[model samples]
Target: MPQHLLLIEDDARLASMVAEYLEQSGFSVNHCGDGLSGLAHLTQPPAGAAPELVVLDLMLPDIDGLEVCRRIRALPAPLSTVPVLMLTAKGDAMDRIIGLEIGADDYLPKPFEPRELLARIRAILRRKVDNPAPNGKTLRFGTLEIDRDARTVTVAGAACDLTSYQFDLLVALAERAGRVLTRDQIMEAVRGRELDAFDRSIDVHMGRIRAAIEADPKDPKRILTVRGVGYVFARQQD
Candidate 1:
């Protein structure tokens, strides 16, 4: 099946153009002009299709774009892993930083080139699919069990739902627990080679992971910061 797309943009003209263009590109597109319906549409998995990517406008008629993004992030499973590319006029440094920080995989400013959006969509999808994830396949960390094949992780009998990226990140740290992995190293291991401005994205991803796995993200005992060097997944087998 072709990749699916959910577009939540309030502009009628923009929405129509984007939907038509994406459909021509062999992607099945669903367009919603308001945020409420857009979010409601995602609550249940589609009968036969789920979106592979979402293009969300930051300004919505009902819910704000950031809330929509967070709600999407809170979703359990395949949905959570779906890449979200934010649409906003706020494309400056701080806006971009916050978007990535708040869980968007990518953000595009208004008046963007259609071609650029398409390219970014491809990149995000490829990044997700090509990365090696050790969770669903299988993992054994004492009483901690990760079944990547099933997309489930359990620690001490408590089930924890994690995004695909989060699970993969944890697996990398678990595999090298006690070893310090620089930001660049972690990026290479989990998210491909380090990009010039991709460091903050890593921090956000790690923070999300720590929130899921650690009892505390503020002062984590599981994943520790090594001051200026990088991070170390605390050695648990001591």
Candidate 2:
């Protein structure tokens, strides 16, 4: 079975090219030219099946891609967790950061190679399938609990809503608590790739994770910043 992908891009020429290429690359591609229609396809699946991944364009006819991403994240479970890879013509760091902060799993600047896009898609999907933790193992730090087999995190017995990527990042950090891991190392461990120097996507993800699991995101303790170094998972979480 080929993985299904929904592409929400307004440029017909580019959409057609990408769809054809991805189809040849062993994916089933569904193309939507506008944000609303794409949202509909995802929220109200045709044939009772939603695409496994969404390749979203930042510029859409009906709505901006950021709004579309927000709306998707607001959808009910399973649907809300669907991985999003944002595509943008803008090379601005702010745009990429904003997209990731809004729950996009990854971002690719436009005029990108199809192979790179395919690789990114595979990387995100692979993270979803691969669980590195030993079965039944759970890591506990004070009130926070990370269950490997269940693929869940709970703070004070209440579940935290983290995306698969964020969950993986947390697990990676927790596995090596009390040690600072550079952004490059952390990215390699969780994303299976080196961090791009200009890409602050990791920081954006960290912010989201803090918001979900921290008592106060403003003063995070569980995942501490090493300041000019990287991040450390506190050995002592109170």
Candidate 3:
């Protein structure tokens, strides 16, 4: 079955163009012109047609994309875990960073090619299907537990809030515990693409992960930085 997608965009012309393009690419596209309707659609999807992903716009008529993402994450399980790909016209890196910090799976700046949008959507969905961790395999480092099959992370038996992409990043680093992997290597491992030179999204995700699992995000103990050598998951941890 073709994957279903929900697009929350206020720009009618752009929404039509994106929805049409995605439908042509074999996805079932449901477009909402405002944030409220988008949330309502997600909350009450048609039978057997729950969206596998969301294409969200930063600028909306009702509420901005960031708030919408936060509300989505706050939903009950399964719904909350659905992947989101953010679209933004803002050239400011901060907007994208904030989006990632709040649980967006990925983001594309405005004026992007529809093909790139399609590619990004496919990549995010692929991560959902092609999980890097083997089924039923759980990685444990002290108090931190990563259950691959369940796609969940817990610290000391308490659930850690992590987006789908953030969970994958933590898994990648944990799987290669104690090895220093550069930013490019990390992105390649998780996203199947090298990190762009100017992209700090990976770092932002790392911060979110740390905030979830670490005793203190500012002074992280589980995921450590190696000065100029990228990051390493400390094999030895509390």
lDDT of 1: 0.75
Question: Candidate 2: how large is its RMSD?
Answer: 1.5
Error of 1 at 105 (Å): 3.4
What's the CA error at residue 220 for candidate 2, in Å? 1.0
Error of 1 at 25 (Å): 3.4
RMSD of each: 3.4, 1.5, 1.3
Best by TM-score: 3
Per-residue C-alpha lDDT of model 2 across residues 1-238, encoded as one tens digit per residue: 8888999999999999999999999999999999999999998777735798999999887899999999998887778888899998767778888888989988889889999999999998988877776554899999999987677899999988787788889999999999999998898887755776677789999999999999999999999999899999999988
Whichever of 2 and 3 has more lDDT, that candidate is: 3
- Per-residue alpha-carbon lDDT of model 1 for 1-238, expressed as tens digits? 8888889998999899988888888888888888788877777547765778889998898888888888887877767767789887844556666766667877788888898788777766766675365345666666567665565678677877565556666777777778998878876676543456543667777787777666667977777889888888866621
Pairs with steric clashes in candidate 2: none
The models' CA-based lDDT, in order, is: 0.75, 0.89, 0.91
lDDT of 3 by residue, 128-214 (tens): 877686645899999999998889899999998888888888998999999999988888888755567688888899999999999
The pairs that clash in candidate 1 are 135-148, 136-147, 136-148, 136-149, 137-148, 137-149
TM-score of 1: 0.78
- By TM-score, the better pick of 1 and 2 is 2
